[model samples]
Target chain A: MVAKELVLKAELRKKLGSKHSAKVRQSGKIPAVVYGHGQEPEMLSLDEHDFVEGLHHGHRLFDVQFEGKTEKLLVKDIQYDHLGKKIIHTDLIRVDLTERVEVEAPLIFKGTPAGSHEGGLLEEHLDHLEIECTVTEIPEAIDVSVKHLGIGDSIHARDIKLPDGIKLITDPDALLISCRLPAVTAAAPAEEAAEEGEEPTSPEVITERKPKEGEEESEK
Target chain B: MALMPKRVKYRKSQRGKMRGNATRTNYVAFGEFGLQSLETKWVTGRQIEAGRVAASHFLERVGRVYIRIFPHKSITKKPLETRMGKGKAEVEQWVACVRPGTVMFEIGGVAENVAKRALARVAHKMPVKCRFVSRRHTIG
Candidate 1:
């Protein structure tokens, strides 16, 4: 389902560059740039607390109001600080509601694969898929049920059932998830040794040996 | 200074391509954020030690820091003015080959601001450029 739209009040930023951005961040605001669909880029500042709260709610698309004008935008990218903790900058792209746009939608697995209980590990290879859909029909995430999956079973992008009007942009053959046996452990060799009633041998160590004087003389 | 192997079976190894996750430990399964490398380089033991020290010092022992890379490959250096025909020089130092997208460090058990600040110090000690990645962010 499409997430609820969040409306945020922002102010047009007159200053540009890193120095100004640093100053803006110091004043409890975040610096952002918005552009797309042939429109000129606009510099803006948002309340730090409000933007962070919206992020906590997984709100990617926003209605940004600045100078009595509001524009619908999708967050294209966000730059975080060196610790991946605080948001340092943001890139917002203007999105038309009626037009279909390609974006990555996260995949949400609904159920545990049946093989998981029998020592089979469920591995999810693709966490998101590129899809095309109208802005109004954009889904927050794509849910895939793995409850029926058994050992050696796999799910590909083509196997997904998209909602009406939504098209998959990623390769249909791309593997999304799979169930496989667990990796072999180091104890396998010891088990084999025990079955034969012999002591387990240590692994061979490869190394270079010093040339003996007699061998050197023989070569000469 | 850092820990060094007392002895190694081989002084040098053949140039091997890091093809398809050769290392068994590939992912940062623990920690909230990871320091992922953007380029391939030889990260020496001293560099890793320095980074660990810097991070631990900054965090003041409140947060846990995980060093994901280990300098296992022995690097040898010849003595000055030595003849070219001599055998391989003794192992001088150890290094860890960091490929693109390798998580070299992981930080957790602390507030976001504290972890970021502590990791920033660690980044300054690294050879290659790195970015902070959250555990929630899926790597492509």
Candidate 2:
């Protein structure tokens, strides 16, 4: 569940497309679309700073105020710029507080694994977990303990312990994290030695090679 | 040794134009943090090796460094003081054509600050401007 209800005021957007979106962004607002519940999609423009700040604060459900009415909306998707740094557009879906929704929650791996002391490296394979639960019961982040991990030990999605009322939606066999020793690169020298023993051959030329001066008479 | 393809169908390749932002392999897929390029250029294998060594040395082998780019395009060069009437020069080196928005290197199994510093050291070895990025820390 969210700590508090974050309310945002939005203005209805009439114009659309890349040009207008760029203009809206230049004016410090983000263009967003709201649709769900078999209703007509409404184009809206939100305060860029408030929207981005809310996302950074991990706000999933938002109470958007538009046209003198308030609607509960869930962040469906966010389109980023080419650099994947700035948010270009946002998609929101209508939702109720009582219905269940599937969301990708961030996974926080806590505790240093005992394997690290034995010259083992801890690697994180997955950072987020897909989960389903009521909108009001959504968790901010899931914490996975790694204190028991030893060398050659790994934790998969099925091994995670979820909070009450939350159901895991990701595949059970997906690997999340693992601890292993560093790989030794001894084969590099051997590969190079083998390559040196092979005869150098010219690559295929699109145009046939011309005959050498001594081979011209023989070819004729 | 630098990252390169063991074998290739062709040795020398045409110098194609580098235009537009990278559409594939632009996001952080494997690791927690990544080094993103801001310009388009050829990243040589030697430079890639240098960056890998830099990051690995800085981390003291505690974490893993994943090189996302491989030098596949072979570059050819003529010998010094050679005549102009000869055929094409031999393959001199290999490079990876890097466009803007490409995640060149990624570091995993380390703290965020450590990853940022390691990527920063790697940025010094790259030919283009680079920035550190992480898994999109956003809720759905």
lDDT of each: 0.76, 0.86
Q: Can you write out model 1's per-residue Cα lDDT over B2-65, one digit (the tens) per residue?
A: 4344456765755465543214333454666678876678889789978887887786545467
Q: What is the RMSD of candidate 1?
A: 10.8
**Model 2: residues with Cα > 4 Å off, grouped in runs:** A185-220, B80-88
Best by DockQ: 2
- For each candidate, what TM-score against the reference? 0.61, 0.87
Clashing pairs in 1: none
Q: Mind giving the per-residue lDDT tens digits that candidate 1 earns over A77-111?
A: 78766344568888888998887878788887778
Candidate 1 deviant stretches above 4 angstroms: A185-220, B1-89, B97-134, B137-140
Residue A208, candidate 1: Cα error in Å is 16
